[model samples]
Target: MASEGGFFSAVWETIKTIFWALIIAGVFRTVFYQPFWIPSGSMKDTLLIGDFLFVNKMAYGYSYASCPSIRLQRFGIDVDAQDICFFLDGDNTRLFGDEPERGDVVVFRHPSTGQDYIKRLVGLPGETVQMIDGVLHINGEPVQLEDGGQFVETYERQGPEGRPPRCENGAVGPGADCIKSRQIETLPGGSSHSILNIGDYRGADDTGVFNVPEGHYFMMGDNRDNSLDSRFPASAGGVGYVPFENLIGRADRIMFSSAGRSMLFFWTWRSDRYFKAIE
Candidate 1:
């Protein structure tokens, strides 16, 4: 009888320890950092589709969740219910408020879709943003641009006959068909990054000047011609001016990356991008 009682006590202690451990982990995840996987090539070259990174949620003050479109989250968390009870009842809670800079790469909840998207911060709260002939212009002044020459990338998942995953930027020589010109464009604060220019006229290439509304920002993708960014209207399938409150966090560095061939295959891992800092 004594031995049985001791066994039960040990089991109870283990249960309690696990309970507290889960509670602490949950709080930490909700407050400090959140893990994210890049599923698209929107911020290509800087961030790839297979890249995994941690978002710094505390970079900006948290805002009350107002998006009604987040019904089912990936972790099975009921974000809608949580927002309704914890954030939406007129108690707009925030802390350590800070705004994103011109070149900061950010991951945010889409204002309309409630879907998360990653893009580079291009326009601030109250600046006029426009793109003229594929050149980024801010406040009616054209931002500086310099040719950084060519960038060629090979697809690990390309088909045998160079079929499905053809390069959209442009083909290289007759042998290699994936090459694009990488241009260096300076932002307002002298922040620069590599942007791809396929030298093609796109719908979002030339856009009407947008007077960024108060408390909102304009974002664009690094892949100039292929990215569907703020230059296009939201109605036409582009992310319009995003509200500051919807900003989730800043993407600082890549934690890991894969080529989508297989996660279990160690050879398929992108070793170079692992733990690389985001510019």
Candidate 2:
């Protein structure tokens, strides 16, 4: 009888251990290294609609559950892992571990509806940002375009590529006449990256200057002609000016990439992009 009781106790302890382990793992995944799927072409030529990315929560800090009004979690938790965050909401709910810098690729909450948006930070707080003929001028110096990148040719018909189809910035359809081959112009910055301009005379090209308000940032998409960024007004669904509190964190790297149609669980994954650093 004693032996039997001991055996049952051991089994119960083992089961409890397994249950707690699963619970801990789930919390770790939910708080750190959450996956995000690209939903639009606004960040095209850089981030495609099918791209799967891992956002680093520890790269910034803990994200609090919005309470009464979504309160941020109190600090001092174990830093064993990080959460993948898409955007930082401005309710003072979450605080970043570090501040953003010029030329950093960032993901933030859209000031309009709190949707996540990723863009290149061009103008910092209290600076003048303007687009002159598709060229970005920060403060007083122009962000000149230097040619070094090769032509990125994609045979996938824009929509039939199995990516989400949207007319947001001029997407027509698969095999559509509007589909034109364009060059990926590499822009030199504090850190250089590529930009796509489909033909010239991009609408927001000739725009009035935007004096970045204090505690706000001026962001633009690498796909200049297509992205509705600070250049567009708030009424038109553009991410006008993001506040410092709205930043989630810096885009550290690309954890994975897949053809628009490939689900993340497939066996034949594009393992090459795994662990590749994001420019």
Candidate 3:
């Protein structure tokens, strides 16, 4: 009888330890950082597909979107941020809120789908943003763009989606050098970053000026031609001006990066990108 009691006590102790560990991890994720995987090439060259980073939740303070959303399909767990912190929804306000700066790489909740998206903040509230002939214009003035040569990659299926990259040279067969024109774009206030251009006068190359609404921000991707960003309306399957409340966090660095389909493949890791700072 004593042996039976001892076995139950050990089991209970193990369960208690696991429960506390989970609680601590949950608190850390909610209050500090959240892990994010780059699943698309929209922000390529700056953030690549298969790159893993931690979003700093404290950067812009706490909101409902700061809550962790777990969606493991294999486990049948589908919890949304709203499910955990629904009481914080509806109001477009945040606790200890701080306005995001221009040229910041930010992750926010999609206004329509509630999914997460990462893009560079280009237009602040009440600023006019336009893309005139593939050049970024702010408040009717064109920002500076200097030639930065070409960005090349192998013309093969990339990432888990097996999508091929579009090339400026166009229609290169597999195993050839796929290239896109690269430029150093300088935003207002001296923030500079690399932007890619595949072709001239393509879709979204020239758009009407967008006057960003108050309490909202305009975002774009470094891979200009491929990104479905503020240039397209949310109703048209694109990210429109995102509200301040939907801001999840800031991506400050790349914790890990893999070039292959699965991150578990250690041979596919990009050793140089480990612990790399996000520009």
Candidate 4:
């Protein structure tokens, strides 16, 4: 009887430890940092698919969007940030908020869909943003762009989605070289990053001037031709001007990366991208 009691006590202790550990992890994720996995190539060379990073939640203070949303269709679990902190919605204000700067890579919640999206903050509040002939213009002044040679990759399926890259060089056989034009774009405040151009005739390359609202921002992906950003309206399947309260956090670096479909595939891990800082 004593042995049976001892076994039950050990089991209870183990359960308690796990419960506390989960609580601590939840708090850390909600307050400090949030893990983000790159599932798309919109950011391209700046941030590739399978790049895993922790967003600094304190960068822009806390908001309802800071709450984590967990969705697992297989488990029939769907909890949105709004579901967890619904009362915090509709305020459009953040606690201890700080304005995000141009060129800072950010992860925010889609205003309409409530899905998370990562993009470079290119336009601040009340700024005019336009893409004229594949060149980005802020307040009618074009940002500086310099030739960055070419970005090349394998013309095969990438990441878990098994999507093939859109190459400026057009369609190529699998395992062949896929290439895109690369440029170094310098923003107004001297923040510079690499941008990839797949073509010059893409629709997003030439867009009407977008006047960013007072508390909203204009975001764009580094892969200009491939990104469906502020250039397209939310009704058209693209994120429109994202509200300030929708901001989640700033991504500073990549903690891990994999090129394969599964992170468990050790052979597909990218050693060079480990702990790499995000520009």
Q: What is the lDDT of residue 230 in candidate 1?
A: 80
How well is each residue in 101-189 modelled by candidate 4, as lDDT tens digits?
99999999988899999999999998999988999999999999999999999998888899999999888999999999999999999
The CA lDDT of each predicted structure is: 0.74, 0.62, 0.92, 0.93
Q: Which residue runs does candidate 2 get wrong by more than 4 Å? A: 1-32, 61-96, 155-189, 200-202, 265-268
- For residue 118, model 3's alpha carbon misses the true position, in angstroms, by 0.6
Please give, for residues 51-126, the per-residue lDDT of candidate 3 as tens digits: 9999999999999999988999999999999999999998888999999999999999999889999999999999
lDDT of 2 by residue, 6-88 (tens): 99999999999999997786566445654566665666666665567766655545443210122245854432112223344
Global Cα RMSD, each model: 4.2, 7.3, 1.2, 1.1
Worst 10 residues of 3 by lDDT: 195-204
Models sorted by lDDT, best on top: 4, 3, 1, 2
Q: Total clashes, candidate 4?
A: 0
> Which residue runs does candidate 1 get wrong by more than 4 Å?
1-11, 65-78, 81-93, 156-176, 199-201, 261-265
> Model 2 — TM-score against the truth?
0.69
TM per candidate: 0.83, 0.69, 0.97, 0.97
> Between prediction 1 and prediction 3, which has the larger TM-score?
3
